[model samples]
Target: MTRRTVRIAMNGVTGRMGYRQHLVRSLLAIREEGGLELEDGTILWPEPVLVGRRAPALRAIAERHGLEHWTTDLDAALADPSVEIYFDAQVTAARAAALRRAVAAGKHLYCEKPTAASLQAALEIARLAQDAGVRTGVVQDKIFLPGLRKLKRLVDGGFFGRILSVRGEFGYWVFEGDWQSAQRPSWNYRAEDGGGITMDMFPHWEYVLHELFGRITTVQALTATHLPQRWDEYGKPYAATADDAVYGVFQLDGGVVAQINSSWAVRVHRDELVEFQVDGEHGSAVAGLRDCRVQHRATTPKPVWNPDLPSTEPFRQQWQEVPGNGEFDNAFKAQWELFLRHVVLDEPWRWDLLAGARGVQLAELGLRSSAEGRRLDVPELTL
Candidate 1:
């Protein structure tokens, strides 16, 4: 079999999500597996060109991974004729401009979501990619999660007969950095840095809801900065200008109402860091990060509400665990392989720049709805 190398210029590998998920767990793992084999007896090998701001950090990462190419200059990386793709995992404020540059360089695009800080910018990026005729995609990792994949399976199999509603609970307390080091970057709480739970999570919710149930038709959101003041990475005090929590109610197509609460201030009380419970006329399912449980109409428990008396029924035990019929790889790696196939073999991929723009649009509308204290109709976005 012929083996070919596809050079990818990856930006922002120094960041948390960039370093851990995209670089180490995904790309490195792919390399360790001896590359992806295409249907035509050709192996598509990935050659990562790490790009970032810091020279020392980039050098360290390159040396640690035994990678050959590392650069601090994006223009130089983009100018390389051998590079076929440009991937961004940069901060929100820096993503749009970097993506624009990549598009201008005629490289295929793939990046983490909330394509831009605003809907307009995201649409503009999408338009540029369309006009450039380059293959493009945005990361929709949550949809690739094992639990969500099983949930999608159930939805496709009509297990949720006439799906009624979806309830999602996500997030856990991120420590204020004064005494305890914050789990997330300080930029995540700074509005000037394009940070906020709404901008960060609404995009995810948009794609997840749209892919699993239907497109969101309307949204009503209530957002808050529960922790007004927090310390930064350096232990310096800073005002938390971004919303730490968001309570959103979205009306989806096909008459499904989804209520999701995203918060960094709330302590975990559930089985996983994130969970989605979908209730239907015939059955109901609760899906966490890696596990899914379902309750059919026949097996669902019926317990009359008795506030005064102690409840006897074990409600949580009523649901049956969904079995994993197949081995699942890392979600990010799975999508990377798909995107690579799309770039090389012209394979069909639905999560394009347009899908990314839709996610940004949802975030913008959600923030607006929260500010206005009223439900807002979601308009269709176009490039």
Candidate 2:
């Protein structure tokens, strides 16, 4: 079978997510699998043209991946008529300018979110793409996870009757780079560098909540900088200006309440780095990255409030495990395939730059809510 290639000028491929998830896992994995088969049976292959600021990094990545195209020049890459898509995985501060250039070049836009540092920039980029008549997509990777997919299945299957509330816990102890090197980059700890728990995580919560349950109508948030001082990559002590933790409550459209706590300072006691528990009249489900367990009302344990006695029931074992029912691909890779199909085949794609702007709006509102120490309404955005 013949393969139809799509050249993607993938910016920021040297970064952790850009390299590992997008390039190595998604595009390369798709290539390894003989690419995506279209309706006409031609395999659609993604050829990544690695773009970044550093020539050595770009060249090294291209050489490592056995990729032929790479450049340190964004303008030159955009000028290439054959490059049909531009994928941005750069830092939040650098994303807007790169996206604007890409949109102007008439390339299809697929990128990581929050698309820009602020809602205005995000909306502008979305509008630019729309005006250019380019197909666009944003990475809403969490919804593609096996656990969330199962959760969505249950929701669509009506397993949860009259859904009531949701609780989400997401965090891990990120090393402060004092004794051990920080797992994440140092820029993530500085507000001036576009770093904050609210900005980093609220967007994720926005899409996840809106998609799985209902659109979030309002949000109340409390943010904290748990660690005031942290050592950077160079072992130099820097004041951590960004909020390391955020506790937020979201009111969805159907009066379903959702509370999510996101923190970089917390130690994990759960099975996964992130988890969500959804409760409804009929049943309740706890879903992690790869596992989802549910307890129907009939099987739910009745525990009377007793401060005098230790729990006798095995609470964790009571819920039934939700099976995959099928093989699951890497979450990032799965979304990549969908975006590829959208671009190459003009298939219906829902998660676009507009959706990305909504995520950004949520983050911005979350910050404002925290600062004002009050609840805030989320207004709808129009292009």
Candidate 3:
């Protein structure tokens, strides 16, 4: 059996998502498990060279993860023929420029979503990658989640006959840092830093909606900077120039209406940080991060609406829990493995740069819809 090693230039390892999801959970975990095994008994090992601006931070991450390579010089890393893939998880505004460099240098591309800050930039990146003949992908990690997978199974099994609507509740309170420290990075609140809840979350919504229901045909969005002032990491206050919350309604190709609420200002009163409820003619289901509950029309309870009497029905107990059919891995890691195969085995990669541009298009158009205070039709994005 032949063994091959793919060296990836992993830029932005110090950031939260890059560190935890990409590096620790996906890359290092794959290496620890003896690499990705192929069907014909070959093993493909992934060797990531940590690339960052800070030498100490890079060195520390490499050492902690028992990795062999760490480099602060991105130019040097890109110039090296040994590095076959270039990944970016930097600030949104900086992504397209870095990606241009990567594609120009003739490296396979994969990175976080909202590939660029704007649709124009995102489409340009896609075009450049196509002209360069490089394999490219953007993270669409939400669909790989267990709960959503279960929801998809129900859809495939015809459990939901003619789906009607989907309601999603996402987000929890992020402290202002006066007393409790904010869970998110301070840059997340600054518009100049390419920060906004709509920009951050719409990509997730785009992929989830397209994959499960259908393509989004139109959108109506209302965004808000709920708390205009918040404390930074240093406990110093700053005016938030970007939205912390968004309320959106999307029209899907299959006539599915999806309404989602994303907010950092609101408190969580649900089962998880994110949850989606789907209603159809035959049944209904609600899915959280790890669990899903379903109630069919046959078993669904009916309650009379009475203003004068207190309701005593066990509403929650009426739904049955969906069984976990099999082992589920980390959502990010699952996509990482598939991407590795797409790069190495010449497999069909559907979630290409074009798909990424579509996500960027949604965010851009969604913002425009909110500003215009009207429903905007979403034109199909093409390369």
Candidate 4:
């Protein structure tokens, strides 16, 4: 039997996510896991070639990973017959054009989210990939997250019987890019660069809501630029043209109301600060990045609310910590492995370009809802 190895060309290898998430964690780390086994017991390994604009950065990354193939020319990598898959981790503004080129070159695509800056662009890319008959996927990493997966399990197990509503609190104060040294790239604060909390986070919530709950049918949103100006990495001030905080209400199928607050201004105050509180008819569940807790009627005990009472005994016993069994891989890396299997072994990967398009649709609708101060019905896209 021939040992099948999928050769992947990674675009934007120098970027933060490209380096840490995709390159190191996903490709190198997963490769070091003795490769991934397919359902048929066949093993698949990824051979990644780092592609970026900077030679020094690319070389440094390649050397750090003990990889020999590194190049600054995208066309050269794309033209290589050995490169069967093209992965894009470029900026949102640059993703469409690059992916289009890759698709035209007949390489399968696995790209970062928002697939494109706008819904139209996303749709076009999806159409292009479909027309070419090439395998394609998007990064819907949150769906693979351990906490979110556990939440899905509870939802599947009917733990939250007839979920009534979902409340998501996601975000932490991003460094002001000044004396604090920004946690994110400077472009993320600018609208022209397709950087904003809404654009960055809505796709994640969309997948989470749709996968764990149901599809969103309508959205009413209000966005704010709380910090009009922010400092860059060098302490240089730049106008924040995009929203730093976004509040949106999504009405899912079956009348499930999901209210999401995604912000860059809030401080991290609790464990698994990014939480999803789901209330149901018989029970409620709260899931975070690290833990999940539930409160069912069977386990709930009647308690009196008192301001001066010591809060040690009543409800504390009711709350149970979900176990962390060390089976959870980084979200991005898990998605990467799934995509690789999908491309090589024909496994079903839900985060396709169409799913990505739907996310962009929701973001666009949210922005329109904010601008018009009216609820917008989300249109379904043909996959």
lDDT of each: 0.95, 0.93, 0.92, 0.87
Residue-wise C-alpha lDDT for candidate 3, range 195-271, written one tens digit per residue: 99999999889999999999999999999999898999899999999999999999999799999999999998999
Tens-digit lDDT string for candidate 4 (72-123): 8899999999899999999999999999999999999998888999988999
What 10-residue stretch in candidate 1 is worst by lDDT? 297-306
Q: RMSD for all candidates, in order, please.
A: 0.7, 0.8, 0.8, 1.9
lDDT of 4 at 345: 72
Quote the positional error of residue 53 for candidate 1 in Å. Answer: 0.8
* Model 4 / residue 319 / CA error / Å: 1.2
**Clashes per candidate, residues 3 or more apart or on different chains:** 0, 0, 0, 0
| C-alpha TM-score for every candidate | 0.99, 0.99, 0.99, 0.95
| lDDT (Cα, tens digit) per residue for candidate 2, span 19-66 | 999999999999999888987889998999989989998888888879
lDDT of 3: 0.92
User: Over the full model, what C-alpha lDDT does candidate 2 score relative to the true structure?
Assistant: 0.93
Q: Which residue pairs overlap in candidate 3's backbone?
A: none
Of 3 and 4, which scores higher on TM-score? 3
Cα lDDT tens digits, model 1, 268-290, are: 99999999999999999999989
Candidate 4 minimal-lDDT segment of 10 residues: 309-318
TM-score (C-alpha) between model 4 and the true structure? 0.95
Residue pairs with backbone atoms closer than 3 Å in model 2 (clashes): none
**Candidates sorted on lDDT, descending:** 1, 2, 3, 4
